[model samples]
Target: MNADEMARELASLGRRVAALEATARPPAVPAMLDQHLDADTVLYAGLGGWDGQTLAWQVVRGWDEIRSAPADASAGVLAALANPTRVRIATELLRRRLTTAELAQRLDQPSPGQLFHHLKELLAAGVVHQPERGTYAVREQHVIPLLSVLCAVLDLRPSVPWEDS
Candidate 1:
């Protein structure tokens, strides 16, 4: 082959190798909302605010833990979208309250074990809630806030903040 043709062939091979590597590596796992699950966490504390059980209170709670690490907030937000499977599972659970079994069936999988794990992760993230045993629902408080934030980010507005009236 001529030099140009050989170079093109090598480039194509490189692209294929890169694609294979990407598929081989485990996609980065999204961080669970509760990086540090605490008794005071709203997930475990019931939807009620501070006065409920009033369990262990950390010096700085939740997002406050990231005060010094501003970058972590952006990273956390980006990581939240890393797993499509989890997102799909969350969407389904939100739409219809499902037991792990039901979710698995809808997913066309024989067992719901993996779906349950994803649900647990989302639960810790505060994106999903368990109102009763084996029943799961989206936590409107948390989900709405996240959705609003996402909408704000994704919403395409004019480049100029103000328009000529």
Candidate 2:
């Protein structure tokens, strides 16, 4: 064809190639899934450990191809949230890092001894962390996201709501 027409066609082809490259490139890593799994397993396969007898066969089918279990946090976080005292303790800890006594005082229902008991339970659940002797805080990076998911799953909500005038 004409010289001008050939130049226009070449430019259109270049634009198409650029668009194709953009579509082919992978997007940025999702924040929710990053650091949530082991480096090698992050892109594919779940991070799970189970006893030989305890694990169901169907669950592990195609395990090699499965990647990261679709962002559901560990079971330990859910267990920690089951207890009311533990949940409150986690909330208080999230507000500010605190010593055992500070957490005890903040929890209205539980006595000091009871609060200590709950703290121990939370520690085992991995939903709370002890930075130093007697100091505790919510395990922010991991447990917070787990709690967010749990809240959505259980449909948790405030007990009272303001009246709309």
Candidate 3:
């Protein structure tokens, strides 16, 4: 083979070796989660806010502890995100901090009062916070947790339509 052809063949062989090495490596077993029957976490690093920072979370709670916790412990947080408008605001905030006017414009919410109303609920629930006077963002520490919750809920799709009783 010519020099160019031989060089291309060598590069392809390197990639195949790398793929084989990756597959040969053992899976990272979440031993703590498996042994304790608890959940792991979601890791996220993104460009967000004016001074962006990586968001990391590793919450591991025993099933019994989770079950025994006060039922209302998360009510405010969940209830705040139950609304369509609030969910939109939250998901947007996850990417970057936004002002009240920006949020309203993006969500097509014409009423400033209405936008504030929803923001208030989110602020109270700890789902979001105002960085300055009016700009809002998902709390830095809560970013991964919030994404985990959204992903888990989104996985609740049914395989087939349910028949009437």
Query: Using lDDT as the measure, which candidate wins?
Result: 3
The numbered model that scores best in TM-score is 3
Off by over 4 Å in 3: 1-51, 159-165
Q: How many clashes show up per model?
A: 0, 2, 0
lDDT of 3: 0.76
lDDT of 2 by residue, 36-94 (tens): 35443413221211221111111112444444444344456577677877777876765
Report the C-alpha lDDT of model 1 over 62-131, residue by residue, as the tens digit.
5454444578655654465447766666657545577766777777665567667777667665667888
lDDT of 3 by residue, 99-155 (tens): 988898899998898999999999998899888997998777788778778877777
Once fitted onto the true fold, the runs of candidate 2 whose alpha carbons sit more than 4 angstroms away are 1-73, 153-165
TM-score ranking from best candidate downward: 3, 2, 1
User: In model 1, how large is the Cα lDDT of residue 2?
Assistant: 100
- Candidate 2 global CA lDDT score: 0.61
TM-score of each: 0.42, 0.47, 0.66
Off by over 4 Å in 1: 1-81, 149-165
TM-score: the better of candidates 2 and 3: 3
The Cα error of candidate 2 at residue 13, in Å, is: 38
